[model samples]
Target: MSVKSAAAKLFAKKIYKKTQGWSSNPIASQKNVLNSLIKEAKKTQFGIDHHFDQIKTFEDFAVQVPIRDYEDLKPYVEKVVKGEENILWKGKPLYFAKTSGTTSGAKYIPLTKESMPYHIEAARNAILHYIHETGNADFVDGKMIFLQGSPILEEKHGIKFGRLSGIVAHFVPKYLQKNRMPSWETNCIEDWETKIDAIVEETFEENMTVISGIPSWVQMYFERLQQKGEKTVGEIFKNFNLFIYGGVNYEPYRAKFENLIGRKVDSIELFPASEGFFAYQDSQKEKGMLLLLNAGIFYEFVKSDDFFSDKPRRYTIGEVELGVNYVLIISTNAGLWGYNIGDTVQFTSLKPYRIIVSGRIKHYISAFGEHVIGKEVECALQEAMEGTNARVNEFTVAPQISPLSGLPYHEWFIEFENEPDDQAIFKEALDNAMRKQNMYYDDLIVGNILQKVVITKVVKNGFQDYMKSIGKLGGQNKIPRLSNDRNIVEVLNIK
Candidate 1:
């Protein structure tokens, strides 16, 4: 190995070991560490004007940098997309991550040198968790299947460049480069229509031990695998052990993947965006994840109520109350300060900084006019799945408006493990769970909001097929579960 590669590996190992047991929970340790880090950041020229240096207390940081959504940074993103220097960071950014959000009119977040390390390190931690989970850390660690986006960016008026994924691929360390699946790294897709085809062809070629990317894309790959009559991982790559997913909930697509692989592949959850990788699945234990606070950002959470209420109070890692749902906010070295990423998560524990992604503050269904968050849907699904051979791989609830009452009704499309003989019981259980968990749903069912729940059993790989149709097959990709707009629902053929 070259000296740089050797040193990189050594450094990675050392940091992992040093921080591994520092505290059973990294969450409790964040306050002191953050306060100290802020103190040190103040010493830097960048943090000086940013007020990181001036803020001593948590309240000070909160007051100094108010909570900001993506809309707040549109002008900054425009500048970054135009390749302007010093819009949010010191140097020219490597690339812009283009992401679509509800309130933000298209975001192109800048990824700078100072902020890249956080993403790299957090992602590395996610891998470590996978290694621990599969207990196959020593397995043929030859190549990892990233299943990520290629760099083929579209600029204004035919002025195009490689996409951010392509740019990041080039910048990844060389040693790690060899570890990536050739299919994921290669920019072969010429357009959106061919992207899924290119990805499906690539995935079948390797003995991918560690698979990473969005669940929706992964599901599409597996759907293609099955369509080709490939049944088991051993049939393609015998040593495959892990499935790393993030960007969106995998609940809808999880079962099909497990059953098709015919092996319990270790699963890892990652919290990443165009901005940076924030937290990752610490599969070393159960429930909650180890937040990568030390990465190129300082993290904060505001209670879900506070995030939506007229008065919102932000809480530091140390200040987070256990079991309460909060919206994630981060101030990164990449120049995104006090940015609310719109994810709703709750602390399962405080010591290690483990959290559960409850739902998106914006990504909920209440078209029936009854507010239903992701957590409520998850609970209802879990309850509904009880006493049946059926297991839901992935699911989404769309509200269908009634012409007569002009009220919204919920239509559930679920991908099941095994198609149940009796659908009515399952539907009843789901309804009962919904009414129990959400008073709004109860009110709707009893009165005027939404009259009844409509349940549909799709082909085991229905969601996967939808993703393939969309041509978004890999990398930081996920199908939105609850979109306010009907375009996605109609396209997916969800009733």
Candidate 2:
């Protein structure tokens, strides 16, 4: 092993013991995090207004604050944007993770001095745990590529601001700087297409071992690499073995990725957002990412089914149950309280609190009461792809309630790198799998209320074209897996 790899393994061993200590007592860790957050923010304007001084227990905290999405909390955020200190967080934010698609155009989530280190630490621990579990740390010695937005930042009211991924680029450890790929000048390229092209040119012959990004954007990178070298990505970068990703489920894209790389690679799933780094895959054997309990954030869960009800009960770490889909709410050191980031998660392991992201609460289909979620759709599609040569590049489903003919149906817009040998049979398999996974969908099929799914084969680069039309071609953006409306499919087919 290289000296760096040996050092990495030793550090991993030290941290693995520390991880086990707190992970073993999750409730206590959560309680301590909640107390610290409340105590630190108590003197802030928001803390005073919400009576944080009187909050002593989870119950007291819950009663003092109510669930609020970005729109509801924008007033305080505006204060911070105008150079105000101790408005939402304890002091002015170090940076704003600017993101698109709020009721108001762009959201500026605070990244406080107290909360930022945990994001970097969570990412580090994920790799460390991988080393501890597998006894492999050689990837640290090879080139690592992180396909992300430009590392450039824009100045705001006394704060630096940019995309979350971009902001994180500034914090990459000095030890890894030489191994990080796609030179800084290339990373600073503003346009994603141009950036990827530059990246392909820079790293195609380099000894890349780890590549991290959202799957869709990384898929574009792989396609470009394939076109340039006329070979599988694995052939081009023989050392590449670890694939790290977030933002969307990888099951639907797994087969396609395997085909592109010419082999299977171990992957780590991360649950990170502008608000906080919530979880990371700590074990290759486990099914879900480990929930972060002591990361300067307190979590709350309201059952997804009851989320929109007049009064949905919030459950803390000790109060949660396994296998229940819950809309995740968080109160963090950055001063977001009773905040709903719109993600829904299901507990897979309660011992150390592992969770699988179920879907986004807003990004699902219940058009005919079928109520299909992102995870179910991804699983069903993966199930159907078994024993078939069918491969998907990307896909999205939308309800076709007022079709031109016969019964209403679900329309699937797919861009395929390789068409199935039997298209009609593949469509049937897709519908059958959907039915098997969801009883509501089965009822809709049997009752003749909805026809089997209709497949609309999107043209090559069709999804890319649609995204380009909207100016969101890459960088942590993805098409929703399922939509209740035809807004996506209507434009997707046009592209």
Candidate 3:
């Protein structure tokens, strides 16, 4: 067995022992967890003065800090930038998590030591859960590759800081440290190009056993491997066993990786963002992800339909019902009290509190005046692909608007496992399916009010390569499945 695997096993045992009897009932046990965190935050240098005064109950938090989007916290973040104390985070803010922004240029999210551990703990829990569910931990012995963001330090106008990704990478277990693969850091908010290149050069041809990151970035890495004359992913990393993906959906890109590698790799999904790691798919059955409810935060769920109501009722972890779609609101040590991260999720089960990412509240395609979410798009794509010999390897849906035409219409960029003869038929079926499910789509199609829906076939890995070219290829990287505007669509203009 590889030394890394042995160490991981040892750590796993320790983790199990530490969390032993810590509640098999996920919901019933969260109150105790939240209480402990609230106490800890009060003790932290940053959280002392701001020890949650109004957050008594989970519902109390919802009422205290009304469900807020990122914009709601912008003013506070600006205060942090001005060196204000007790605004965004307490203590000297360690650094900002430079994140991808849709409307803004790029977000510099401040992080504090009080809340940094939440991200680390969430990751640790994810690792533990993966081992517990798969039991592959017993047999598998290989190096793990983290297809992560840059680990470089940045100095913006004399303020010195490194990326939060860099900080996390720095603290990984010393033994398995050799397993991290090198990635380019050209535009990395940090200018550690030389050091980053050195790290990658040292690990070339090493025994990389598991790979994890954004599906798109991982695809880019595989393409880079191909350019280096490596015929298959397995050939490049002969010891690989696990592939973990996060930030965006992996369903569309799954087949391409399997085909290129010529073997099936165990896959896991992580629901992580610049804010924190929230969900993890550790189970082998590919069920819903388990959440990190107690990692320096208190979580509340509000029914998505009830969001704009005068009195929106929120549910605690224990009170949440199964099969209901809810918008997640969080109160974290980072001074975000009942902050809404914009993603919508549905509870699949109650035992371990398993939930599926339904879609983003902001991410929708209403081009034809039909509001369609991520889940709806996923359903439409699945229905269209059913019974078809050709499997959809990857896809992006957007609304194309032309000033001359004066109306916008649906457009899809589809990548198939194998080219199909009847491309028109596939597009027709998908459009028909979407219209049947969404009344807005049905009206547009029946009245011929908007431009006809169109699908364009791209070479395999086309979009993946496009994202990589822009240096966005990892867990925090975003690939929108639905867009009603042309601004985001233009990002895909690359060949």
Question: Among these predicted structures, which one has the highest lDDT?
Answer: 2
Worst lDDT run of 10 residues, candidate 2, spans 98-107
Q: Which residue runs does candidate 2 get wrong by more than 4 Å?
A: 364-495
Clashing pairs in 2: none
TM-score of candidate 1 relative to the true fold: 0.66
Residues 1-495, candidate 1, lDDT per residue (tens digit)? 445434545554665675565445555455554565565446443456567756777678777767787777666656656666555666566556654333323456766667766667677766654544444554334467666556556564222344345556656656577676655435445443256556557767665677776654555566567666556654566778777777656665567577777767667787777767767777646787767766656788888876778768777776788889888888776677788877788888666677877866777774433446666777778887778887777777776653355434677777777766788887888888878777546744653435567776666567778888888766667766665445565655432
> What is the lDDT for 239 in model 1?
77
lDDT, residue 119, candidate 3: 77
| Number of clashes found in candidate 2 | 0
Q: Write down the TM-score of every candidate.
A: 0.66, 0.76, 0.67
Query: Per-residue CA lDDT of candidate 3, range 1-495, in tens?
Result: 566556767777676555444436565457765665555455433344344554576554444456666676676666666665655544546667765333433456666677777677766666776776555563244456665545666755333355455657755755445444553343232322333344344444767777776664466556556556458877777767788777666665678789777789887777876677777775778578877654666788889889878878878877788888899887666666567877789988676677888866667874332556565677778887887776877777886644345444687777778655677787777888776566546645553445556777767677787779778876687677777565545655422
RMSD of 2: 13.6
Worst ten in a row by lDDT for model 3: 187-196
Q: Please write out the lDDT profile of model 2 over residues 415-460, one tens digit for every residue.
A: 8878889988888899998887776577557646578998888998
